[model samples]
Target: MGQKTALGSLLKRIGNSNQGKVVPGWGATPVMAFVGAMLIIFLLIMLNIYNQSVLLQGFSVDWNGV
Candidate 1:
């Protein structure tokens, strides 16, 4: 109980401290956008790889029963 109150107050104080502050270089929105773009690119690349693997598997042949 006491610990929770202390943590809550600490978080509130920290939040209040940053309310009117200015951060330099690449704020949250641009950073988040960049991260989102990178994630999308990564997902596309992975999807392409998976599709190619599946297509290649379709072309594989077994010659053990002659």
Candidate 2:
């Protein structure tokens, strides 16, 4: 019925509108956190590889003494 459709539309509009906030954005927090965590993880992995490579090379260089 027309009344049913109108009521459903009104409910949808009310749910979708964010009543006014100081900052406007629906999904900035989780997205930013995900990106930041990924960046930190990538940097940590790179650092670990660099450290392991250096330690291996150092040991190889001193193999004759050991």
Best by lDDT: 1
Task: Give lDDT: candidate 1, residue 28.
Answer: 95
Q: Model 2's lDDT to the true fold? A: 0.73
Model 2: residues with Cα > 4 Å off, grouped in runs: 1-26, 53-66
| Superposed Cα deviation of residue 14, candidate 2 (Å) | 26
- Per-residue CA lDDT of candidate 2, range 1-66, in tens? 345688888998999787665675665889989999999999987777656753544444334676
For model 1, the stretches where C-alpha displacement exceeds 4 angstroms are 1-12, 15-26, 53-66
RMSD of each: 7.4, 9.8
Error of 1 at 11 (Å): 5.4
Q: How would you encode candidate 1's per-residue C-alpha lDDT over 1-66 as one tens digit per residue?
A: 345588888999888987878989776988899999999999987777656643554443335533
TM-score of 1: 0.45
| Candidate 2: pairs in clash | none
